[model samples]
Target: MRSTLRSSPQSTPAFSLIEVLIGVLILALGLLGLAAVFPVVVRQQRTAADQTQGLIVARNAEAYLRGHTLTTTRSVPNASVPGGGLLAPSDPIPEQNRRGLDILRYQGVTATNPYSTWSFNAANPDRPGPWEIPTYSLVYTNPDRGNMLVAATNQTAGVQFAQRDRLWPAAYSSVDTRVDDNKYANEPRYIWDVATRRVDPGTPSNVGDDGIQFAVFVRRIDSSIRVSRRDLINDPNDPLRLSRPTRDLRLADVLTGDRLGLGGVVTLQRAEHRVAVAVTNNSNSPVPTLNGEGEYAMPMRMQIEAIDDPDGQGLSRFLLPSSATDIQRRLLREPGQKFVDNLGNIYTVVKATFDKNPPNTSNPPEVQPENERRSILVSPAASANAAALAASGDLQVVFTPQVPAAVHVFTMEPR
Candidate 1:
């Protein structure tokens, strides 16, 4: 056959060594580009997911604040702490308890300090900060939420709350001044430190809560605004009452350019709106009826309500303390009386005290354009007009029989 098959077509020409190397180099470059692209793609994807979740969390918090806490009617002050009272950086609805949310509110209402938010206690009831303080709230048990103590600090493993035992003597140091003085003296310690993610050894958690554990961090990224104690207090009667800034306090502007608006940081605006859900249990109380707010915790205090009017008029109110001295006289002063609410739940009356105003003291002389003596509902700061009004007896007292008492309509378990 034409042995000229050309000897098997002379074996296909072998690729040159340089040509092969170039081909390999091209393939390697393609793979390198893909590898680089993968990380970027992953990062972008993660950011998008975080942002979406954040929006939901933020809105939920906003709704909760509006629903539970009352927003102070603000009137941007013209001067720094205009009334010269106990100034706080934030609007101190209760400078002493603005967001304290401690059940102690009901306890001390009839004491020397009519209300904690109105008074400052050096030994007990540690005041947190010009931060969001809870005055009223209801906590319910939700086992579905797992250990959240770890989540508060963004850690994989959480600190054992029970191991820490919130006893003030155990966890605190004599020289510890950064926290409230009553750091861990109470039971059911609730106030948690974000930096340490540990319960404040001095504050009360719920009546029987093992401890507070949350999945979301009370994420804050703003620099601390050293708010004046005078600024935070409210002087309802002071014509020159200092008010909050008309505009919102922004994190980026207050602290660094890098702020919570960016994905990796935390920030704080105020307490009313929470960015996360906070829960704890053992009380097994029913979830309070929430408003159109989001699924978030209200700045709440662990409160105990008494329904029995020892006077029987149903108008007799009680303000009992849980302090050492108060406990000794608990049965004598705050006699227990069984009561049933609309829900048919029974609660034992804890204390009974007069709802009448305390006796007026020899008014202290004015200091720095304001009164130095601040009572339970009294603000130290005042305006010239406030003084004139007080003198004329035209100044309206925040507390009076006119203001209706806050009695739980439904029945709740008594502490």
Candidate 2:
């Protein structure tokens, strides 16, 4: 065999400098593309997150308002409390830790920025001439006790004796002036001054003398009121119902009555009584009574009752019939009312029976001969007598939102 010089195949030369540069250039371009896309992705994610957070805050606020009934006492415009606005009467109750309403005073909404508002020292000694934001005068009273009839003194015998003594008078007597003079002298005066920006001297300045008194109380929506008519009808004794059956089927049937359409009557049985109560509108208006066929009256009692689920599933449901519409229109449909905040956020009130009956029960249960049912919508407007209730600070009720940071506060005056 010829030992041919088998020269090993020489290995190819390594890549040229130009080739190396090209490869690096390609890699750099790819890296640049990735860098460009990263910021866009991050921005989109951040925007989505912000929108979701804002939506959550809004929905939480709406649910909170719907879950509990609102009254002038607690929902006072620009009311203040320890955390912010006026504190609800139930604020002191331990059980209301999570369920109480928060009066969210909306400062304003910023598209891509944090929200801010004018601030002042409520207790600042140096700031002169009352804080810019008017302070509220809240007078709370016992509607039952303050307005109850009392034996008149011998001086006024012919007239039926009336309990002229107010449990929570809106203003302080000259002898009992505690807050500054410019401040509301009484609960009623305070609320009136704050709401209407006008001072009012309540009628009959003397104690034990009939005069306007106002009070407001705040209470959570008791679990009993949370149940729907169907649920209550099915299981009247459900612990969630928060009511009792004092009598047999006859009494139960009579109390519930045929108008309700449920075979058995569900008796709330003073459930309203057990609710945390507060009063507002203690200031005495020159008119004395807020008149409008008793409709659209302030200091109205807000009662909430779960209705028979239209879907028949025994659960409460809110439906939007219109698909292409704004939130305000949806919330203001028939059987519903719209409540807009200062920021123009709209809320709706769905129509439902507050009690087993279509209408509310007379305040004094005994006053009605057969416990007549009344519709809250159709019931007489808040009585002018409510002015007295307001003066005592008994008519104002405070509604505090659960999330303090998200609520907007503003005033809604009578139209």
Candidate 3:
């Protein structure tokens, strides 16, 4: 009887095939849900990485800009070129792209042109809308940066005299017998003549003919000089300044002192407080040579500093102090002050000096209507009465591009 009961109970112990299939189906559904969400998660992570990379690139660029001073001209040295120290890339991209940095330049003080504008959505040359145009110069050794050639005269003969080998016969007389031909007589004359190979001395050195003839020849030695603004602008061979403007304008005339809160007055003594451009040559080629033409590299630290009034007075009489008195009390009350912006927005100043015209008088006589009498007089410290002031005086605008530590990136877009 026990064995029969045990066998009957065992028959109901195992799960049905349908139940097993249902369990498998539940497990499969969970896996399917996980699979569907996996791609979205991965995409999100990739997007985050791209954004981080972009920010890093921008920051690096800014840092570079801030560290360097602003200059009318820039030079990217051949030595700065990566890999090929002597050859610069024809285009700024690929080299800059791989580095995650993009460069843009402007010819004038203000970047008003579309080509000179910087944007993140600029397209490639072949693409539409967003486009980037980066400039690069061919790499060459700069002879101006102390890499110069000097002609050292050595007296190889017993009675050696200095004789300059003139490249331009017209500038130097071949038959001039009165010139002293001694060791120091014609020893490569002026520095310009030696470096430029120009024989034009404008004046000739001559003494009574005294059979004191010396043989002088030029020998190239290395030296260098700092690049100058005129050199970059006047050099026809330089690609960067080939189209630079030749017009002359004083710095004071170009910048409005009033806008900078400098009282519309310019003084030479205050020149130190004014902003001045600093030029740097990153090019491998030195100044006075056309090899680095059209190559200007901007540093991150370039900035402009001008005068600014912290009290917000000193520009124009339009910004002045006003008084609102309690007529019944006969006591000087709150004075009104207003600051106007370029957009015609008026801001009220809470506290100001209050003065009574009729001292000790209980009731000061009213001159005109309250609206008309309330004159927005300019303070003595205010600069100009012009609608908009040029960015000038104690004010400083530092253009420090944010560059990232790990990467370089250039992005351009429409304004």
lDDT score of residue 202 within candidate 3: 12
lDDT of each model, Cα atoms only? 0.25, 0.25, 0.23
CA deviation > 4 Å runs, candidate 3? 1-9, 49-57, 70-132, 135-415
Predicted structure 2: clash tally: 79
The residue ranges of model 2 lying beyond 4 angstroms of the native Cα positions read 1-14, 70-415
Clashes of each: 35, 79, 85
- The top-ranked prediction according to TM-score is 1
Lowest lDDT sum, 10 consecutive residues, model 1, at 398-407
lDDT score, candidate 2? 0.25
What's model 1's TM-score? 0.23
Residue range 1-415, candidate 2, lDDT tens digits: 7787655657546788999999999999999999999999997785465345444434433333333222111211222110112222112222221111213222222223221122212232121111111112221222222111111111112111111111112112322233542222332110110011001111212101111111221111111222112324235454433443221222112112211222332344332112111221212211111111110012211112222233333223222212212322221232423222111222333442233332334554334332232211211122333323333322322112110112222332211
Give candidate 3's error at residue 391 in angstroms. Answer: 31
Please state every model's RMSD to the true fold in angstroms.
27.5, 28.1, 30.8
